[model samples]
Target: MPILQWLTRDEDTRAVRSVPYRLLQEESALSCGDPDAANMLIHGDNLDALKALLPFYAGRVKCIYIDPPYNTRSAFEHYDDNLEHSKWLAMMWPRLELLRDLLAEDGSIWVSIDDNEVHYLKVIMDEVFGRKNFTSTIVWQKRIGPDSRAILGAAHDYIVVYSKNLEAFKATANKIPLREDQIAEFQNPDNDPRGPWTSSSNFSAQGFRKNQMYKIVTPGGAEYYPPEGRCWVTIESEYFRLLKEGRMWFGRDGRGMPRKKTYLKEREGQATWSWWSNSEVGHTQESKKEIIALFGASNTFDTPKPERLIQRILHIATNPGELVLDSFLGSGTTAAVAHKMGRHYIGIEMGDHAVTHCAPRLQKVIEGEQGGISKSVNWQGGGGFRFYRLGPPVFDEDGHVREDIRFPTLAAHVWFSETNAPWKGKGKSPFLGHHDGKGYALLYNGILGDRRPDGGNVLTRSTLQIIREAAAKKAPTFDGPLTIYGEQSRLGPTTLARENITFKQTPYDVRARR
Candidate 1:
């Protein structure tokens, strides 16, 4: 595989690992509608938010759509869109690595970008996601009128798509729904019982084939052969079979070259094309109007994406109830679309607009605002999302576990560090659940609340008795070694080794990573 190197490539490549895991602090007051919703809108640096999400959402997201800054060198009120080439690569490298980890095996990622850094973005994406998984680059007509600034006006942008595993995506990738114009093309001219149908050219552009160059005699006794340089699409036997089945069509006079009738009943959907027109999806002006309508003209974000564009993406890439994440939650179009389409979503943003623009608009969505894509998706809208902020880093800048870290938070971190699995059990005493034949236990924040020297957070004869009782109830026949993390332990190394136990002292073992 090839790699794109920049000024800070080596440093930025390993940046995600060095990033400290931070707990997501939910703000009940900031969240709207329901408190137990699956969707989330996080306010913080997106890189930190993505890192925070990994312990819970790794390998679980069904789709991810991000519209990062285009590096167009223009200033916007909400963000700095301009960066030097190496700095831009430095910024994008780590986020891509984390996003790749969050995708399910059959999932895909779509990124919207313009010409300024698209070539570089492709090279880096090829490096991050394997080149074998690269899907086609869709050309979106974003504008209608030409700009007079340059010799040739720019009117389009690119959407580079890649699948986590191309083979898996191929098995379940969806077809596009037929547009009104496309449905109108199917007409029941013959009034056949098979329903409305459309006529398509039946000749192949390929050269002569053995059985494809056949002769057909029409009802008027006119002999027709394949055109001057074309051949029949199939062998004569199949053509005659379809003709007998009434799937073949001739002109009203029944003397023209034969064509094939494709019935609407036989179509599941239309295959998506690489070129997307503005009339089909949407354009920049429409997207801005939607923002103005939602925010009431005073609080518009820069370069908001059209909801129709995201709706199209969701229709093709995901199903209802699947998880979708947008780390760069600029104007929150992705989350709104995902919500309206009945898929769960997580949106992360650094700017304060996450509260002002993203959260407020979502509240309107829950109240049944019939704006962008609402009518199309039939969104009567009663679902909700939780709002979160990135808390202080779990390990502080000096690499020490913070004194304020709670038991559940520490247990989550420990389970992730030990097994790299999501913790599903209630954070309780004696047992933290088992994975890969090893049982984990955390005794932090004085789980038993004795506060004495031989408390629950300490490993003693009493603590061992509690552990044994809990394990017998949780895993009765388990004989695997128990890895216990605690504040202190009174058991000797000889006794600990004999009992098939390994005790790691907390705050000491945890802080060593820093």
Candidate 2:
């Protein structure tokens, strides 16, 4: 079968190879360095780190919030930002696989994206995370009013929500602090058994079916009924109980149609809405002001979200100690917020700025240095993280290994490059070349000293002797091909084919680096 059966024929398929997806192999690597630590700062390729995180976090995380690249061609020039639709799909498929493995059965994943790839991402997510798990596409107003150009102002971004299991997932409570103005609404003039209270409409719009346009008479013979076509939210049985319990309110002298008393003391904030505009949360301008406040004019992160905004999200989505992840950890706002709230967090970034910007920012949060709500929260510094790079990409410019890699990275790169190569690169292997395992891998750093002074060169003779001796020590009768990696024609033609030896040159036309 064709390897790229999932893609259209026109779609350019980067050659795929098998990679041993990067996953953490060390048990100690999973522990919070600080006994008091609650968050993680992982500095490595997310694709690899996510894979490494699987064993420890699978079916364990409560919520995941990733600001993955929007595939905004303009936003990511450093990574191959301008992928054709199919190519971009190719890019995300595998990472989603690992992410799914890490999600708890009751977990939720919130992805942020714009129009460039929203629809496409939805389809792919359905396939990877299961359509049954889909929750809602919460719209966030990233910008305010109109730009007055092109069809839409492109002012909004979307937060795509998906659940590991629909029946099992529920958003956490969002407790908006009581405001001074709202506090005035409370009163207990009659001194009921319950504490403070507030009056609410006797009618409710839900399933009222206009039957609740009920009329009742006050002591003064004045009669009142709900407006036409409106009905009470509560049933008559419950309404009467409230009246008997003094939980119902009526005008001056025990008035006309009664209203229910919704005790302000008992109520939480308003229910969260799916569509959040800048007014509800914040605007881009607000985000800019925050950047200036935190790091000053000297530092400016491309997309900085307000701490309060993140607080709202954290409040709605998860509880303390639950794991939260941010793969596109731009300025580390998510991690910083999660940490301050005492939730376990993992943040991944591919930029150097993550170190200079995100690391320091998080360290500051840990120390509880800056004021604001963060300081008031009483967080103390503790947790630590080890930063790792992806070493080198699997494929080189020309179809050959860029260089030999350490054991773990080599295993992961080999697996993914073969399965779902996340990176777009010229065809080349990171190893010198492929060879039999169990013994020394057929490593031939091609004899660059081909033009030796002593009458030509003995590079092939030396290499052949090395391979035969290495294999002889392991398997006496094992005389296989000496698969060597080298520039074509570097060592001239060899007559080793008769000795069960093959020397295929690394292809020279591999994709070049940017």
Candidate 3:
């Protein structure tokens, strides 16, 4: 691991600068009143919201499901749809950092991606989250049938599951909507109070050596025996005990071979495995049909996930009231299913399209005005969410200074991304006038403007004015690094060195991070 150091007293030591990064909307705190509120819709750069969530939800989330931009090189119009391979890795690196932190000790994150970045994502996840934390890369049959024109049908998508720590988290087993064939297996042969029952094999393949050679009497005096070279898993003593206890069953005539009865009411549902095919959930056809049934066939977005598909994932990955977060909420399908299932959810979408598309769809589900799974599915819908968006980015923007930006936005940007903790004062800015040993820091868009709303611009004025003012009391230097943003030379070389602080700025080109 590389070291990110800052606050070096001497020029010899590197400053600590490696802090967790996430996108959060810079805004006044919006109140939704359900502190244990199960639902949230965060609108901003995901990098920030994810960072903000770390403080409260670190190791607290139960399930995380994200369907990020697939890197298909196809534009979504709303999201800046492409990042070069390395850039994509860099962009995802920080988000993964925060995701790992916010996950509950026993929680898991499921990422949905296609062929483009799946392999690379797996490797990076292994590097950052640890390969030991890997659960499985479930191959979902994304399409039900054949479209034979192509050399091979690209009919599947992969859902990669990862845990915070290999031994810490596990996905809760989910119940599948009982199918007719499964339901039919249970019969009320004796019309027991349990409703229905299914028979199970009671014979074991080990341990029952004495019973291994025992004979079974049939209804017509025929003696049936264990096959050659095989032994019962249990002893003859236990078989007799089971038979006496009525756990074992012979023919209705009470003279046939023995079997075990599995009462339907007593059995937990079948356990789910990793394989998921599109037919049970839905493929493109089923996905589109669902959209049409709800919003009409004409409704379309560059990309939309099927609700049934989301339900399938939620079904296997979470339980009631568990937190389910979707950083790439697209159309809010995860929230929709989670809400219907009585789970708490938090969704983060960066597109302006959220207000028009994501919000409305979620509202319908909450108000019970929408049908979630339109086919033979039944969803009991009820729950709510509060919506939020990022305020303006920083204290400065464009060619000239904008006086309207608040001090808080600047402070949050500094401390959250800074290498140091125990930052003094609030708001998001790095500057709070003259103080003691530590203060705030801010550098953005090639502009490093650090000054409080009150006219204390410390860099140009005092370096140790406070330390001398109160001889008995110690005050933190209360100024920040005179970091340079944009081109270092734009602010003049002599001015840059006088501040004696580190300078950093974002590269403007969309391609730079890669």
Candidate 4:
């Protein structure tokens, strides 16, 4: 596949790998409602927050929705929304990488963007998510009126959808419910025993099969043949069967072209299409009013999306209790919608509004305030979310691992680095976890009660023996090679080779510089 290359392509390509892992510090005092709820509202730079979430959430999220900065050069009260082209691409590439990792194999991601960067974003996403996974570019009408500044008014934006695996997503995808007007189209005109019905064409233009060109006789004894270049959609035998069962329809005169009577009882809903109108979903004005109602102010956020829009997305992408995430929390519309819809959510934002705008709005949701999508989703409200702040960087300016880092945190990092999988173990011992038929172990934070950097943190004969015994107790049948990451290794190459051990020095070997 051809790639989208920009000035900072090389630098941005390596950016996600170079992002230093950070710790999440929960602020229990600011958290509201129940503590057992799995929802989270994280206040920090989103890039770092995404990295912090990987250890526990990778491959667990069912849906992700993000409304990133459009790079429109328009200044807002909270977001800059302005950056050089290359700079914007650099900022976005790494975040996309982390989001892709957090997505489950059967999950999908929806991104909202406008014309200024939509084309570029598509090319970049095609590279990140495989081109085969590209789903559709939905045109969302964001305005009821037109813009007078340009020769042609721009009234719509787009939401691009991509699935982690196209085949897997197809198995679970649902259809959109029929609109009132669509339901009106089906009526019981002939008073048939089968309820309301609609007519569908019964002819094909290809005329590929000779048996599909047979004649038809109407109830009034009128004869008919296939049109000039068309053939019947079914074979003669099947057409006779449908005719005998009263499933075939002719015009009111009883001599018109044959049609199939589609009954309403067999219909679940309509398949989704690419066009979404403001009248059906929402518009910019409605979105602004929603933000005002939640925050009790105007201009708090210039580009907040409407909760109904997110609700529509959640309706198709998620189910009750599934994990949903939004990295650009903005006015917190995505989280609010997810909560009301009964989905667990994790929202990340950098601005002060994460506290001032996002958290307080959720508190109202827990209190059963009917606003935005509450009435739509029938949310009487009873759930909670914890609030957190980003802690110090995992690595210092001098490229040394922070001394205050805990064993579990370091273990999560080492497991991710060596196996490229989220660390799900509790780090009960030096043995972190096993993946791809290999056992990974980490020696940090003096798990052996020796605090010296080169003492308990080093891989020596005794450390190896301890890990072997622990591995036997936990993963008894495991015979894979052991890869250990530590402060240092005292054992020589001969011993390492003979024991099937691979050692990586800590700090420099694991720290991410960017």
Overall lDDT per candidate, in order of appearance: 0.86, 0.60, 0.60, 0.86
lDDT tens digits, residue span 1-514, model 4: 8898899899899988767677899999879898889899999999999988886788888999999999999897898988887888999899999999999998999999999999989999999999999988999999888887878888998999999998888787777778889899998877889999998966555655788888888876688888777787889999889888988888778877788888888888778788998877888999988877877775468877877788888888888899999999998899999988899999999999998989999999999978787786788979999999999887787666777788888788777767667777874689886898999888877887685744678888888888898888779999888898888898999999898888987766776523
In TM-score terms, candidate 3 sits at 0.66
Task: For candidate 2, write residues 1-514 as lDDT tens digits.
Answer: 1122346523322222233233333224333345445456666777767755553455677778877666676654334456677767766776676677667777888887789988888887887678888888878888767778767678788888888887777644345555477788888876876888888755455444544556556545776655555667665676667667777667667754566787875787666668876766676777777667767877776666766667667767787878888877887788878877878887887777567767777767655645334654666655554344434443554434444433333333333333233222222222223233312222223332333422112235555565465456546765444444223323445464465444443323222211
- Please give the lDDT score at residue 361 for candidate 4: 92
All candidates: TM-score: 0.87, 0.65, 0.66, 0.85
Candidate 2 accuracy as lDDT: 0.60
Candidate with better TM-score, 1 vs 3: 1
lDDT of 1: 0.86
Model 4 misplaced stretches (Cα beyond 4 Å): 1-5, 148-151, 189-195, 203-205, 218-220, 237-247, 250-256, 396-403, 426-432, 441-514
> Candidate 3 — what's its lDDT?
0.60
Report the C-alpha lDDT of model 1 over 32-96, residue by residue, as the tens digit. 98666699999999898988887677778989999999899999899898799899899999999
RMSD of each: 3.6, 13.4, 11.4, 3.9
368: Cα error in model 1, Å: 0.9
Residue 377 of model 3: what lDDT? Answer: 41
The best candidate in terms of lDDT: 1
Which scores higher on lDDT, 3 or 4?
A: 4
